[model samples]
Target chain A: MNRAPGLKTYAVIYLLFLYGPILILPLFAFNDASIVAFPLAGFTTKWFAEMWADPNLWKALKNSLIIALSTATLSTVLGIFAARSSVRYKWPGKPVVMGFIMLPLVLPEMIVAMSLLIVLLGIGINLSIFTVIMGHVLMCTPFAVAILTSAFQSLDRSLEEAALDLGESAASTFRLIILPLVMPGILSSFLITFTISIDEFIVANFLGSGQPILSVYIFGQFRFPAKVPSMLALGTILVGVSVVLLAIAEYFRRRGIARTGGKDTGGFL
Target chain B: MTFSPDRPTMIEFRDVHKYYGDYHALRGINGTIRAGEFFSLLGPSGCGKTTLLRTIAGFEGIDNGAVLIDGKDMAKVPANARPTNMVFQSYAIFPHMSVAENVGFGLRRDPRSRTEKAAAVEEALEMVGLKGYGARAAHALSGGQRQRVALARALILKPKVLLLDEPLSALDKKMREHMQVELIKLQRQVGITFILVTHDQEEALVMSDRIAVMFEGQIAQLADPETLYRRPNGRKVADFIGTMNFIPCQILSETGGRIEVEAKGLGRVMLDEDQVPPARGEGEPVVGLRPETLTMLYPGQEPQERAVAGRIDEVIYFGDMTYYDVFIGGTDVEVRLSMRNVPGRPVLDVGTEVQLAWSPSALVLFR
Candidate 1:
């Protein structure tokens, strides 16, 4: 309530600066004119129609979905193992090993893509959608591990022990108790990794070769000035989809917290 | 003090020893827990009381010796296959399940029909005074309710031994007292061996049929509650269980099962062999006496036993009881005496002269 007026205005300006370009995408996507300049362009649905009718865009979308889903599944599954061990056990040189695993989160994506491309070529491997998936998985696993580790840490150690003591084997205990408790964290990790993989440009461009990836195809579409309006329409739809996906992930995360009677610390809403 | 010869030993530990890294825990433990008896392992923290209980439940393995349950060696059995169940201190009610689900969790592998298993769950809930609570969510229950659910869960299995690891430590004082009586009644109803691990001396004394007093990973003494409080085996055991005033003394003579010692404040006394614990350490011998055994005489009261002249130095008043720290005549030592506050009796002030009366049989010489 006592917020300074100067600081309040600065925060408002800061938010507008961050989201100003995104707000313009929907504006132009529904505008009657192809020109992006303001002057009250009338509303029209032609650009959205054009974006939906493109066969090449549909093919690229299919390829991106396959890579994102595969990357999300593989990274999250591997993340569970890494996160569980890191949270529950102590080992020598663990810091160094985990550092290497998380290095991709901060390392420049272009450098990682270049190194991976050179490695793939040196090994006589052909670059394709599979290659793109491998790159995306590598980039997304660190996020998955970080998220899942917090989930595993919030769980009580005695719950698993109680199940085991009550005549359940170790495997069954994990399946019945551990899985249900951490399932929310797993879903969040998968959604976040999926979002990261779908829009990834550097790795898809470098490792995908001539294969049609949505990000690479969108970049190619920008070469022609006529396709600019339709690209804006596509960007608007993607923004809506991303917002809905985040809302859904947050919903499940909150429900998971409630199911386990845990307090809600801030999550990725 | 007297155990029936017909009651079988339900569990036995023979020279059990355990070590964590370089720290020795559970050093050569040997004891027998009788069938259908309420046994307690009482000790301070890091005394390996919980470790010993866990060994019986198959949660821990001994470095040497064997744990025998129902006269069979349990060295190879895992915890899931063991014939013991534990009510954990935290209650450990599965947060995601209903109360009925949590209670009936152990019954998942039971080959009985669904109706029979449901009936059993209902019976267990009723046994713990949680009737009509099967439909409630586990996380919504209170602390006392959670404890009852945990009890029902462990009891539903009908394990040979029910282990409780400080189950009442989490409750408030009033709730803890209520649960103590409830647990005793429940144990009698179930007719199974109950093993409790607790650091609270009062709780152990109130609930246990036999208590094993552990110190630094070793059983110092195992006896009934009265004997443990009255004739603690060592200085440490006596000091840990309750308040005792130790008077340094000199051993004058030793006869058949009798020893005479000249105590500092209480003068000379003859102690039978049962009244004397095994002598430990060197230098001067000592005799230990409980606070309640020593009494202060009011005006016009004749001493029924031998009396010592003393002056009250400090008065600690409780609502129903008062403890007076009295300094004996011609000695630097002070002894505490607790007296119940009767309606017509007056609370003695500090520095008031009084005669303290005590019996010779109540003194335990520790040399």
Candidate 2:
């Protein structure tokens, strides 16, 4: 097949448009100037040092880590049960129930945040990191379910039956066969949900109020012109962490496919 | 033919009936599988052959009737507790485990020590001709190797009855034929009753000592391969097993346990009681003869007993044999005659006049 130069140029332009801002973040982070413009400034690690020195940044990072961890664990646990049941058994109103469970994905996050705040306050619950965690879980669960469902769907039902036929009980068969086969799916779900929860802004802003959540804290720091350089450094670190996490997730997913001798269906690489 | 008292019954189904919502999966299934016998449930897809096999394995529940394994009712027994293990159609070799781990899986609850279990897995692998393959990951093996692993894994438990749900269906033709012979030898070596469910008639015929032909959730006929091929009870049974040319015939007279039928393609012939199965329905009786039963008499060759004049309608040349579709005695019904391709013999062309040799005893009359 002949390659079209026009199509190649279009692809290059599209990718540059997508990654251009992300590429500039690191360039400005390492540049020795406060302004994020051209005419390249000299190199410096001082912005990274300044980022590390901020106590509020550390507190916000801790809060975001706590929310991400909790949301990932909670959603993935729920996802496993949902995905397994959806794949294995037929139940009454299955589509409707699964649809409702996944509704938060399509439902506007701002709307979910606003309504959750109203409900929580109506129930006399105070705004805290806990509320923000609940909001994050609701937003992240659909993604967890989507990934886990694919994992569970690819599994052969005969593997479970063969385990039982070989004298293993239901629980033992799950532990020995089912769990190990779908481990990559669970890992993928956890990482994706964790990433989503950490970067989510609306839920954090609506539920946390004055709480030191990373997204909300970052928005506040944008008001200070001097703090933008250190924020760029923080953004560079986040981009690096996300790339590494995604790489690790894709590695496990591919390894799982190889171990099972299954055909490589494309994943979210 | 009923199972005699001399051979002990390993698994018996007494009026077994099962339904899946509105669909009748198995209806009033009654049969006996003899001890140390290679039995097969043969049928087309959705004919409930696999369902019947799963009932023996206790993977399926019977709505009414009882399934007995060694004269013990299996109603309350679960699949794991049943004295049967299955070689699944997919082979179900655990992809994450080594071949040894898969074969040793059934021994997890056994009271044997680790070394004894390892030795047993080794022996089982050897039985299936997969010796020294225990260390290899199951995912790395080919389809044939995986089937062997499944066979070894199922046999490791030494269950009273080994249920095979189309275990060789995944293999290619050559591998499937090879495994068919190996399975027969393995059954004889182990001396265990093996019940195989398959849609392949040749596989069942090649591997089983006795076969139960099923159609529409019922066992149409239960007999050995030769009997099934030579004398199917009804038209449906005759059609499913192998090729049988059905020529419309009229019953001319009925004598003492003898009936003479005037067939359309061939002349009148007398059929003994054994040659005529009991009438299953009120319809015009037809004479069924196998393709190989009708032979094409070549040049300089004589049919010592009997012969019919025929004109070749079509000639299908197989490498070893030639099938000639001949219109016998000016009749429109074309009876197929098979001739061996030997040296100095020529393939017959279409529209060639020929003589066909056959016997009356080989004809099965079905109403």
Candidate 3:
């Protein structure tokens, strides 16, 4: 049967409630008044232009870029090796290893962030972008691995065997054939990890020091009302970039899945 | 016990014993394949035909046997390093690649100029009758086109041997027949040893120069298709290769190298001891008759003397032919005969009692 019209209106209200504040941040960055209120005070682009001129903002941006890039590269590489090895051959403790690699995906981020924080402090390793990278890798590696595993599994095993039958060695076959076929998956994994590293706040909050990432910096900017609109402008930019990166990542993911004949959920499932 | 000192043997399985854990896949298989001949390893799925082909292609490693290619031991030879290519059952054409790239992939094994590669790709595509269609992605091609692309990819490399694992199993009947002839033509043009693994009896019969019928990881019979069908080694070979009606029989007497056997359903009849000598005294005697070997006519209507009495239970007319399932002396025997439209023909309907007759030599007596 059909739902009532009131319920549909309620559902729309709920969706607006979720995104209303974040959407307003971009709107008010262009507002004329410095104070962000229900009635947008006036019209101005001073805050957005100032966000560009600030030297510290540029340094913080550079730092975040370095961490996210390293996180994307390192996590994706490690994920590829782990995924390929796990998929191609059956070995003892394979289930256990796979479970361990995937454990971070299910475990609460708070628990993981705190545990990793404790371990670094216990090992006398000072908190920095390196520690932050380690944490991001821990958080994002599972996703990268998960992405590549399905791509590898969806492949026809005979394709590899046919390569062998034609006289390509195991390593050469991987380099020339298997790698190219799953390039979409690898690209998706890289894009996904970069987005996660860029937007992730919880682990970066606890682990970051000396040079804080963009997320922690944004959080630090929340305390001062004078820097409020600038942070919103900055956040507006981050939100836009994250949305674009995530959209690209999702596009690659959906295309990869469709190419491999996998189910497309469109995030509903 | 001298090996061939002439042209190299394309492939050999030397005492190959393969095991998927405890289940034995291949057992002590030792055979040499002559170069440039079409040989088929024909059997049911679990009979290790595909396993044998994969072993030769270096896709599978045996538990005990050595797979040798061109007389060289392929113990540590990985798949790509082996001078053998395969057309897989699914026709593993790279979905992301265009037809040209797929056929040209193996040609990149050694460095070549781009012009040479392009020329070679064009020639290979032309060989498969897909010359100008190289730019289309593999998924866009039809099933038959995909199959040709796979063939071109494997054949273009000029490998020492071409292994086909149930290559035409995915195709429809008409397409399969056309491809079978096309493959044979391609094999003749390329002159490489083509080792086909298939379970389809008609496919094995219609294509291969010689078929090695396997059962339970062992070669049961290896012969040309006609000989294999006509002179099957055992009841299993006879039953698997074609349809033959079997009946329990008792040997009543023996004379002139012929046996008078009393079929459970038919009275005393003389059966010829043909290619397979009838061991009358050993085991339970059985008589096998091809359905086509018997003809049904109305009672007392036989021009000659020999006939078995029967009543037609069903006559299924299938366009060019009709099959009459007849009940003769309490036995249901299937009699297949050609249906030709001639004037004043006998219209034998259901419940029509008739006499089925055949030459005694048509009876394949076995024990």
Candidate 4:
């Protein structure tokens, strides 16, 4: 095939436009100057040290970790039930129910946060980290269900029937066969939901009342010009963590497909 | 034809019927499968063969009939509680488990100790010619090996009846033929009543002691393989089982224990009472003859009782046997006949005038 002139250059520019800003975070984080701008600055680790010593930053990190962990576990558990029933059984109103479950994936996060704040306040529930966790779960569950549903759908129906024919009860068959086959999918779901909850800004900012959260705290620190360099360092670390976590998730997803002897029908890379 | 008269019944379907929404899957199936017999439910697809097999395994529930296994009503029994096991069409080997784990899966509820169960798994594996394969991953095995594993897994439990649903359909031709003999031997050694569901007529004829041919969710005929091939109850069963050349005929007279019919190009002949099956009102009266029953005689060879003058219209060579479609006796009726390719005999060519020899006893009148 003859190449179109400048196609390669166009591709390179397109990729740069998508990710060039993310590449800038680490560069500015390591720069020695306080101002985030051009002109070469000498290297320094002082901003990283400053970030490590902040007590308020540590508090916010602890709160974010708790919320992300809780949201990941709860949403993945709910996803298993929803995906299993949706894939295996037929019932009245199934499409409508599944549609409602997946609606939060496309619903704007700002609107979701505003309505949830109104409902929680109107119900007389005090805002806390727990409320922030609830909001994150609602937002993350649709993603978990989408991933796990494909995993469950790839399984052969005869495998379950063969187990039952071999005298295994329904529950034992699920524990022995169904759970192990879809374990990698569960891991992928957990990692994705955890990543979503950790970086989530709108819901965490609106629902946490006055509690310290990493996203909200980072937003507040932007008011101080001198604190900007340390915040950039923290952002650089977050980017590195996200990349590693997603890589691990993709690895397990590929391994699961290999274990089942199924074709790699592309997955999240 | 080899079935004895004294064996007890293992499974019985009493007017079973099944439905899937508006589609009637199994209309009303009634039959009995004898103990220690290798039985088959044979039909084309959508003929309710698999549905009937599942009803015995308790995987499917009939709408208005009873399925009895070993004289016990299985209406309330779940699939896991039934005394029957199935080798699925896909074999359904657990991709995540080793061969040993899959074979011993059903032993979880057994009262035996661990080592004793392990020995039993080994014995089952040996029975299926997969003795040293228990440690290998199931996903790595070939199609034939997976079928063997599925067999060993189902037979290890020693169920009263074993159900197989087209277990050899996934293999190539050579492998499928090899497994058919193995399945027959395994069925005999275990002495468990085996029921197989297959859409391939040849597979059913080769592996089953008796076969129940189904059509449109009902049992069209149930008899031994030899009887099914030799004396099908109607034209539909006769056509489905093998190649039968149907020639138009007219009933001339009926006598005591005899039926006189004038067949096309073959002249008049008298048929025995057994040769005339009960009328099914299918179509016009016709006489059916198997291709192998008719033989082409060479020059100076004597006819076996009766002979019809025929001209060879088409010749199909099958290595050892040659099939010729002959237009018999100044008529447009073409019937196929097979002749053995002996060392001294020559293959007949098209447009050759040959005398086709057939007997009156081989003719089955379907009216």
Top-lDDT structure, candidate number = 4
- DockQ (model 2, Cα): 0.80
lDDT of 3 by residue, B21-129 (tens): 9999888887778887788999887998988887877767888968888889999976767788888899988766778888888877658898898888889889988
Q: After aligning candidate 3 to the native by TM-score, how far in Å is the CA of A104 from where it should be?
A: 1.3
Q: Which residue pairs in candidate 4 have backbone atoms (N, alpha carbon, C) closer than 3 angstroms, thus clashing?
A: none
lDDT value, residue A101 of candidate 2: 91
Residue A207 Cα positional deviation in candidate 4, in Å, after optimal superposition: 1.6
Number of colliding residue pairs in each model: 0, 0, 8, 0
- The lDDT per prediction is 0.92, 0.90, 0.80, 0.93
Of 2 and 4, the candidate ahead on DockQ is: 4
* Residue-level lDDT for B14 in candidate 3: 80
Candidate 2, which segments miss by more than 4 Å at Cα? B1-5, B298-302
Candidate 3 chain B, run of 10 with poorest lDDT:
B1-10
Question: Which pairs of residues collide in candidate 3?
Answer: A32-A42, A32-A43, A164-B79, A164-B80, A167-B80, A167-B81, A168-B80, B16-B65
Query: Model 2 chain B, poorest ten-residue lDDT window?
Result: B1-10
Lowest summed lDDT across 10 adjacent residues in model 4 chain B is found at B1-10
lDDT of 2 by residue, B1-367 (tens): 3334469988889999999999999999998989989999999999999999888877889999999999999999988788889999988889999999999999999999999999999999998889999999999999999999999999999999999999888899999999999998898899899999999999988888899999999999999988899888889988988888999999999999899999997889999998888856937789999999888777768987678889999888989999888899888998887788999889978988888888999999998
Root-mean-square deviation (CA) per prediction:
1.9, 1.9, 4.0, 1.7
Evaluate model 3: give its lDDT.
0.80
For residues B162-229, what per-residue lDDT tens digits would candidate 4 score against the true structure? 99999999999999999999999898899999999999999999999999999999999999888999
lDDT tens digits, residue span A1-269, model 4: 44875898898899999999989988989999999999959899999999999999999999999999999999999999999999999999999999999999999999999999999999999999999999999999999999999989988899999999998888999999999998988998999899899989999999999799999999999999999999999999999988888888899888877876768888678
lDDT by residue (tens digit), candidate 1, A66-130: 99999999999999999998988889999999999999999999999999999999999999999
